[model samples]
Target chain A: MRSGAAVLVEALRQEKVDLLFAYPGGSVIPIFDALYDAPDIKLILPRHEQGGGHMADGYARACGRVGVVIATSGPGATNLVTALATANFDSVPLVAITGQVKTKLIGNDAFQEADITGITRPVTKHNFLVRNVDELGHCLTAAFHIARTGRPGPVLVDIPVDVSMAKTDVPLPTEVHLAGYRPHVEGNLRQIRIAAEAINQAQRPVIYAGGGIIISGASDLLRQLAEKSNCPVTTTLMGLGCFPGRSPLSLGMLGMHGTFYANYAIMESDLVVALGARFDDRITGDVTKFAPGARIIHVDIDPASISKNIKVDIPVVGDARLVLEKLVELVHFVERRDWLARIEGWKKKHPLTYSSGGLRPQYVIEQLDEAAPDDAIICTEVGQNQMWTAQYYKFKIPRTFVSSGGLGTMGYGLPAAIGAQLACPGRRVIDVAGDGSIQMNIQELATAVQNKLPVVVCILNNGHLGMVRQWQQLFYKSRYSGTILEGNPDFVKLAEAYGALGRRVTEAKDVRGALDEALASGRTYVLDFVVEPEENVFPMVPAGEAIDRMIGGMT
Target chain B: MTESKQVISAVVENRPGVLAHISGLFASRGYNIDSLAVGETENPLYSRITVVARGDEAILEQIRKQLAKVIDVIRVTELSGQNFVERDLMLIKVNAPAAKRGEILELAEVFEGKIVDIGVKHIMIEISGPEQKIEAFVELVRPYGIHELVRTGRVAMLRGVSGRPARAAESGEEKKSKN
Candidate 1:
């Protein structure tokens, strides 16, 4: 008879979990002991539980697999809240295992005991509390299955100390029999035909892609559909790399910090084909006025996201790639040269531009794009740096741009970059971060260096929280408040302290060279680009305004 | 925002935190839950949850689909437009003075409610029926001075063999007729 820990390990092995990001504690010693004997599963330790959780999220996003994280109960389990919410919001598949106090000690206010399953219920897609050793194997199996299936999300399984240590002869079930949960995968043929007819009849058509395209591995189908229909494409911040950024028909990203042409195309289009995108408030500014003239055709795997924001004329719920494969088959080529010319005119009239001299954040992102390897993964911390990277980085391939899009969590960059590097070994991974956001999880530098993962972190140090400062400047009468970072650490010295290569580039001309040198160092590097302090991300549709009312900069 | 009350009933797995998962879904989304009731179904392995929420058509639709999306939720059905029976159980303790005791008892009889307990200064009445009937009963006894009140929110079931069609046994004829 095997111990419960062995059965758990065997289940994870059956699920093909090769790597686990973990932080050990008193309650989880049994599982750690099992890991000691297991040769195939590798465990990478992080300094903080939060960092490890974000790393798992990054790994899942980069590899399109179920990322796993293990932590002790109470404080350790609570630390994973942010990452769990982040993965749930973005639909990334992650399985989080937290060790609770013994079953008998639970609810008695025992040390290191917390209701982890209850606390994480809302944040996680599904959560389980292991009360019995017999349920341990199945709980884990179900957790992994639920996390990676359908509209993927984070699942948490809280194992009490006794449950982990208890011996059991129960074997792992070959199949999970969740009677209530069966994900609908196939696209309804009637809806597909309706969408095809809409695409064929529309004169000015635009395809709006979201992160779901990348999640479903539908970039190829998206490109084919865009090319076949001769339609311009506008992607949400999460959908950045689903279509080639440099393509003539590509409008880059559309939303609060979207391109002028992209926002305009969405406004003017007669037919809007929304693919795998939830109509979130950020993207659909002033929902009543969003795409007012367009007959929207929304395709998503989750039925709830279809009419949650802007109502659609046609709703198709299915996997992105599957729906697109059938859609492309039914679609016929159509020409709209006049519509293309109008988009070209808009692009020429209001191109993304930044005045020279002080090292603009946009310019730094462009330089990083130039110096990075072809397969480099770009992760970003929130705020101006994230928007700049989304706006300026020319992502030609899918799964290369990873960021905390839906949750907009700060300090996600460094840990995510580490996870991405581990997911795609030998690949160059960079975390583009803002000055304020980088410090949120800067301690992960040690985690990166210790793990020998040569990931780069590019901090756009502007001595201020750029996005909030911009909002204060535009709407708050320039009252900066607590947005400014008056005293900041010397990032170069900080990187050195962490035993990672450090470089600072102040001049615009040296930005590219600094990035190149850092990448060539073959060590975990931190390149601090001291950018223009007061620069603002433009083509922004002010909150509560319609997308067509975008102002400033290119607009 | 044109808000209207929509009653939604869902059958979920009788597992720990399943109620929290459902209630949390509404709370996190900034959706208000006007009333909620949960109890075990005929099958001990499942529980039926009924939620009354006020929102526009879009918000109501979102709630239904989102509730259905939960892993443990087996089926979700909106009971607003359907021929469904809804009920709420309430126990009210009122100060029925010696002179007003007969009057309060008469009102309870009119409402088809029963006097469950008679204290020295107060009497407890038990009532279970549609919300409107309960509300009317409470209003009639309000003058007797209510000392305490407890309600079980709202629970609903479709008339006859009518509910959200089970995924496993979805027949063509079931789709043709509401029943």
Candidate 2:
């Protein structure tokens, strides 16, 4: 006979979980004790449950594995709400194991008792509440299976403390039999043929890719389909690295805050082949008028995502890689010189640019991209820093750029970088963060230092909530009410206090040097680049407006 | 795209949180649920949920797809376009004075409703029929004054030989055999 906690650990071993991000509490001490004897699974503790959750998200995105996070009940589980929503929105595979109050005390207002399963229902792909020790092993295995399969999202398994402590001799189930859950992986032949015919008959075709490309490991197939069809490609923010950013046929990103030429191309295209992309509001500003002239062919694994936002003429439901593989096989080469010339002209006329006088965030990101290794992974906090990195950095490979795209969670960077660093031990990981966003999870610095993970955090310290400030400047008549961040701590000293290296650069000339030193320091480092406060992300399509209509920096 | 009512039937694993999952999906997506009914199907491990919602074609398509995406939902079918039979059961307590007792009984007989209980001052009638029939009956009895009324929403099934088979049963049997 073995304790339920030991059985749980054995199940983790069965799942081949090498790294587990967790935080201990009163309800989880039994499991923590079991973890003490299990040497195969390395448990990394975070200061807060939220940080641990985001770390798991980043680890999943980086390694294409089911990221696991464990926390106690009540507050510990609630703290993971934001991270779970973030992962759900991005469709990152994550399994969250939370310790619940004892089964007897449940629903009786026991201490540290919360209905975690019910609370996380909408945010998670699936969830379970284990009522007994026999259900514990099955729930865990099923959680991982559901998290990693079929459009992949976070799954939560809430195990009561008594169940975790109860001894059970039942062997762990080797198979999952979820009768209601089965993902459709193969594309219909008729749909593929119809899509191929549409592509062949089109003159101006643009390929729009999203995070699904990375999730499906279809970047290569996507590139093949694009090249075979001679189609120009544009990606959403989450799809930054799915296509080589430096390729001639690449339109870096398309949508709000997208490249000027990319929006123009999308607006003017005769046909748009969307692969694994949901037409989110950010991508389809003024949905009624978005890509008005384009005949859209949307291919996604989720049937609901096909026509959720914008209507599609042809809908192909299947795995991204499988569909793209068939599409690559069926599509013939086509050359549209006129379409290519028009796009090139627009690209030359409206290249992404900013005023180069003061210390600019764009310039710092460019410098970092130049100094970083070819395979270095770059993560970003939300706001101006994320948009700038998406614009300036050239991502040549998939799984190299990690950011919170759908939920737009701030403070996701530092902890995500820690997870990425651990996921890819040899690759240099960097988190391009904003001054306002970094403070939300700055306490994660201790976790990174304690783990001795050499991850660099490049903070663009502009002393304001830069994205909101930009919106207020343009739309709200420059009434920057609460956007300004005041009395911020000296980040360099804070880093030193955590026993990590830190540097502050206030000049444009020193940006490159600071990045080089931080990258070479072989320690957890923070490079704070004091950037221009008023600088705004341009080529902006104001919310609820047409994608082609812009406010500033068109040229 | 004009808005029209559509009936959706979903077979799902019978569990504690399944109802919340289905209802929450509707609430979150801004889909209006006119009425909903759920009960155990032929298989004890599964439940069938019938939902009446108002939406256009696009909205209906989205509702069907989203429902199917729920992990516990085994299958979702839109019973609007097909020939289906829908029924709602209601229990209504109407004030029946000595003078109106005979009239109330006569009205219940016309509607094929059964008089479940007779109180000192009221008559409780159990009525099960299509929504329109039930509504008409309620309106006819409005003159007598209703004390209390409760409806079981709507439950629907396809008509004729085109009914939904015991697919849930087959799956359960498959699992049993596998074990």
The candidates' DockQ values read 0.37, 0.41
Q: What DockQ would candidate 2 receive versus the native complex?
A: 0.41
Q: Residue A191 of candidate 1: its Cα lDDT?
A: 94
| Model 1 CA deviation exceeding 4 Å by range | B119-122, B162-179
The 10-residue segment of model 2 chain A with minimum total lDDT is: A546-555
Candidate 1 residue-wise lDDT, B37-64, digit = tens: 9998766777889999988888888888
lDDT score for residue A261 of model 2: 89
Clashing pairs in 2: none
Error of 2 at A477 (Å): 1.2
Docking class of 1: acceptable
**CA lDDT of A130 in candidate 2?**
89
- Displacement of the residue A49 alpha carbon in candidate 2, Å: 0.5
What is candidate 1's lDDT per residue for A1-555, written digit by digit as tens?
Answer: 788788889988999899989999988889999999987998989888999999999999999989999999899999999999999999999999999998989999999888888888878888889899998888888988889878899999899888888999988986787766777767889999999999999989999999989999999999999998888999998898899988999998998989888888988889999998998888888998888789999988888888878888999888899999999999988888899999999999988877777888888988888888767899999999999899899998888998999999998888998889899997889999998999999999999999888898899999998899999999999999999898899999999999999988889989888888888888999988988899998878999899989888853
- In candidate 1 chain A, where is summed lDDT lowest over 10 consecutive residues? A177-186
- TM-score of candidate 2's chain B against its reference? 0.91
Q: Against the hidden reference, what TM-scores do the models get?
A: 0.95, 0.98
